[model samples]
Target: MQSVERTFELLELMADSGGEVALSDLAEQSGLPLPTIHRIIRTLVNNGYARQQPSRRYALGPRLIRLGETASRALGSWARPYLAELTEITGESANMAVLDGEQIVYVAQAPSPHSMRMFTEVGRRVDAHATAVGKAVLATMPADEVAQLLARTPMSPKTENTITTIESMHEELERIRARGYSIDDGEQEVGVRCFAVAVPGAPAGAAISISGPEARMTRISTDEVIPLMQRLASSLSAELSASA
Candidate 1:
């Protein structure tokens, strides 16, 4: 592997372990000699990116929290305007969710004007099969990955409306493609419906959705919602691509 890639691999190992890792363990995990791992870790500690613990284990240093927060703020800022536009256009709740493994993470959200609605909390992780945003992003992946994720985390029925089988999910994805958007149909929560579209070129784990109470969402059917969602997704794609 390239030196930068290898360095990141080591960092990820540390990060996954909550910043503390034994030198021997790091060497074993990274397939590098203990001496080499020690040298690299020394450089990282000196640079304030990592530190060693009392037990001789290394952990992410204080500076990493600053860097992580900065990156998250930047990404949230980039997504906020797009989410605002979706909520503005749909006059309902809009959310930006990114895939984290088999779950979808809500990074940004705007609630509807109505008093009663299904609101997802920011930073909350939920089952992908339960949300419109999840389905939208899932549709963008290759079929094999879709099958793999479903296998690793078997579909559990979240509601009477939830999709509980991989075959059903595959069919739903096909329909998402055919219709150019996704529909939640109270799958995640009863009496809540959502419309969604893929955020094109998102780093393999992102989507956008507009959701509201069933009574209101039914007014905007697939034909109406799909066009607006497609337009917004097109604009978001342009914005993200240009930024990339």
Candidate 2:
């Protein structure tokens, strides 16, 4: 059990380091002894979970890609029913997205019944600073880390309402934290409004959202919509945790 935990710790630390690290750095970051780190890393290398790079740093092995892609597909598959239910209840498009590095990747979506509804296709990637689902999940991250992530992205405005500065993003995230949900307010698209809430206790940065035309997803309706999104997000969190 201890070895298993240590192995995961090393893997997580490697991931945080952008998929590669030196042995000494891993020891320092994980607070594990050099010998212990070496032993676990050796086993990982032997099994193709980690590899010694040409530069002598250890990198996450290519083999993990298959596992990650499979798990991502499974996660999307499991979350679709919940997204579909939310779409049915809210009469809007429902989406599930996860933070992948500095980008938010839409994984699953159920379209609204309205013919003129907003559509964010599955596998579409967008900057984290420009979307409600992005803000919802980023609001759950540490302030410094969020800043670092934003620094890496271009912060380009998708629409006039998109957040284009780190300071503004911080302010937006604070409001999202207080409200327990996020509003897009035509940020990602000129005429669309979006509402999102993080899936608590799921993966590091997972969120669910509903979107529609701004005229339909109005401020007056927000009072009702937010609660439904929050409740469904909570339900999803529980189901995901239980399945894990």
Candidate 3:
């Protein structure tokens, strides 16, 4: 059991290091002896769960892709009920997204009953800087980490309200932190609005959001929306943590 735990810890450490690392770096990061890491890495490599790069660093292997896709599907299945409840409460489309590298990937969604409601397809990827779910997930990360992530991605403007500068994004994140939620005021598309909150204690950086047409969304007070989203986010967080 301890060996199993250590092996997974090493894999997680490698993932945190952007999916590749040297043995020495893994040893230092995991506080495990070099020999133990080497042995575990050798086993993983033999099983095709990891590979040795030409640079001699270890990286997650192609074998993990199937597992990751399976896990993502499972996560979406688990989130659907919560998303449905959120949509039922808010009368808007509800979405669950996870941070995948520098992008936000929608894993699950419950569409609003309205004929003219927001709809983002499951598995769609979008820029983190232009979406409420992305900003909500980013707000939970360290400032330096967030900076690094943003630096790697182009902050292209999707709409006039999109935040196109790092400084402005930082300010927006600050406001999100202070308010405990993030908002997309037609930043991703004209005449659409979104409200999102990070799911605490999720195994990965994740957020849930509700979105709809701006005209109808404005009719609902933020005071009513934010608290409801927070409560649902907290419930989903607890469920995820327990399952993890």
- The TM-score leader among the candidates is 2
What tens digits encode model 3's per-residue C-alpha lDDT throughout 1-244? 9999999998888776778889999988788999999999999999999999999999998899788778778888888998999899889999999987678889999999999999899989999999999999999999998897888788999999999999999999999999999999999999999999999877679999999999998888889888888888888888777887
Off by over 4 Å in 2: 52-54
62-129, model 1: which lDDT tens digit per residue? 88767655654555567778778767777888888877657787878877777776688887888888
Predicted model with the maximum lDDT: 3
Which stretches in model 1 have alpha-carbon errors above 4 Å?
A: 6-72
Candidate 1 lDDT score at position 227: 74
The total number of steric clashes, by the backbone 3 Å criterion, in model 2 comes to: 0
Q: How far is each candidate from the true structure, as Cα RMSD in Å?
A: 4.9, 2.2, 2.3
Model 3 Cα shift for residue 187 (angstroms): 2.5
State model 3's lDDT.
0.91
lDDT of 3 at 44: 96
lDDT of 2 by residue, 1-244 (tens): 9999999999988877767889999988899999999999999999999999999999998788787667778879988998889888888999999987678888889999999998887889898898999999999999998987787678998988888999999999999999899988888889988889999987858999998888888843777877887888888888888898
Which has the higher TM-score value, candidate number 2 or candidate number 3? 2
What's the best-to-worst order under lDDT?
3, 2, 1
